[model samples]
Target: MQITLPRIGTVAAWRQQVRKLAAAGIDPQAVIWSVGAAAPDLFATAAPAPGVATPLMLSLEAVDGIEMALLHSDPERFSRAHALVLRLSKREVRWGDRSDPLMRRLLDQQKAVGREIHKMHGFVRFREVSPPGANRRAFAAWFEPDHPVLEAAAPFFARRFGDMDWLIATPTLTARCEAGEMRIEETEARQPPPKDAAEELWRVYFASIFNPARLMVKAMKSHMPQKYWKNLPEADLIPDLIRSAETRVRAMHDPSAPAPETLPGGRMRKKLR
Candidate 1:
């Protein structure tokens, strides 16, 4: 039997199909699983009718793990998940048992999906896309993730930027929030959004918060990977900031250095005597 699943709501679709196949006593290896639009398989047969209603009896942990692992970009993810689900339902394999290779692989993939979600939350940079004088401000962002994580990661943005209208576009899909309602649709454009006026202010604020005396190159790179730098407005200043960190730190320690003049409101002037 051959099963082709739509990209959106894939987890729900897979669950429904797998239940029927399991009830029919079909082997996971005997079925061909393809996601999105694909050429029809020549030798594919019609799916078997479910023989009887049998509860899968999967634990909450197992269900969550399977759902997260399915979001991974690996083409074999569906088959592997299906196999694991069968084993789990039959009590043939224990959840979180590193002794089983299949269980271990699924666990690792689940963690990978989680890490990708974290990166998406931290890295997406939005720019204003709404025209001036618009009643509600709108913004847009472009992100490329290692996994199919837009569904998993978009809710964080909705809660954080609830007052404004925004959209996040990825290669496969786009998530848009308008009037407090969020919708997911096919991507309209592959290119990143245009730069807006506020980016300069964001860059300046980034520079101001940079602490040269406490610079840690490796740590910074770990938190913000190089792949995401191109999309960030503050990333352009990183090279210069890193190069000058030592000099700035030295100046801070040098007692002979001229004291910066204090301006009104306790702000220090940038110019030094």
Candidate 2:
């Protein structure tokens, strides 16, 4: 039986559908899953009523892992997760076994999604925008994420910026928060937003706080991947910063280094002598 799920299915939706399938004794092999709008399949059989019987439960760790794994960009993630869940329900198995390819892949996907979430939290830069007649200022950001994680990652923004309205738009989805409530919805490709005045200040602050003496390009890339650089305000300055790091650090250590000149706006510019 062909079962068409939503293009971006959530944990609750999958849980509800899985409960019905499990109650009806519909094994994973008997059903083929495709992601799209839910439409009546011409050759599909009607699903049976979900009985009152308690469905099989997975451990909390496994459940969390599968939920995050499902958010991965892999097209076959649903099928793989479904198969694993079926095997888990049928008998006792080490869900965390790395020796098992399926389990290992799922765990890896889960970790990738987790890292994407962290990146989104760190990289999303909101720009203030004002519409006529608006009382409180509204902010917006455009981002491109590697995984379908905006749904899972939106809550952090809602809690962090509860006092203001904000929108985070991505290729696949958008998260909007207003008056302490957050909503996620589908979106298409979007162009980069206009430059905000605040970005300049952020750039200056980033440059000032950067420690050239502690430069570690490899370790920095591991934590802050290059994929996210385009969306970050401080990223464009990275190349120049890295190139001049040695000079800056050497000047700082030199006893004969020229005194810093006071620039306009009380900023100090070190003259590398």
Candidate 3:
């Protein structure tokens, strides 16, 4: 049987379909799963009607793991999740068993999705997009995640920016929050938000807070990957900050070093003399 699921609400659709298949005692190998509008399998048989028996019941942990794994970018995630669920329901395999390759892969995928969600929460930068004299401020951001994670990550933004109207656009989907209501829709294209005046102040603040003595390029890169740097306003200063870190550190240690000169706007400038 061929099951084509929509890109949006994929997890819910898959869950409903899996319940029916499980109730009908359908083998995982007998079903073909595809997302979006894909060509149908010409030779595949129709899905059997759901039986009177109750659908498979799994532990909450297993259900959460499968849902998270399905959010991964892997095209085969649906099929793998279905197979794992069947195995789990039949008591053929145990959950979180590293010895089982399928279980291990799904667990790893779940972790990857979790990491992506974390990155999305920390990395999304909103630019003011509100028009003149607007009642509530509006902002927009563009993000490209490795996985289709906007659905899972958007709730954080809604809670964080509940007072304002905002839109976060991704490659596959867009999350919009207006009047405290949040909704997700398919994205037409990848278009970044326009630069705003506040970004300059943000860049200045970022540079001011940077501590040369605590600089760790490797650690910084690990926390803030280069892939996301392009979208950040402060990232433009990173290269120069790294280049001058050694000199700044030496200045901090030198007993005879000249005191820093204070400039307008409360900024600091070092004197050569």
Q: Top lDDT: which candidate number?
A: 3
Q: Residue-pair clashes per candidate, as listed?
A: 0, 0, 0
- Residues 94-201 of candidate 3 have per-residue lDDT tens digits of 889979999999999999999999999998989999999999999999998999999999999999899999999998899999999999998986889899987777
User: Which residues of candidate 3, in runs, are more than 4 Å off?
Assistant: 48-55, 255-273
User: What does the lDDT come to for candidate 3?
Assistant: 0.86
Q: Judged by TM-score relative to the true structure, which candidate is superior, 1 or 2? A: 1
- Pick by TM-score: which candidate is best? 3
Q: Against the true structure, what is each candidate's TM-score?
A: 0.88, 0.86, 0.90
Q: Per the 3 Å backbone cut-off, how many clashing residue pairs does candidate 3 have?
A: 0
Count residue pairs with overlapping backbones in model 1: 0
Worst 10 residues of 2 by lDDT: 259-268
Q: lDDT of candidate 1 vs native? A: 0.85
Q: Could you tell me which residue pairs clash in candidate 2?
A: none
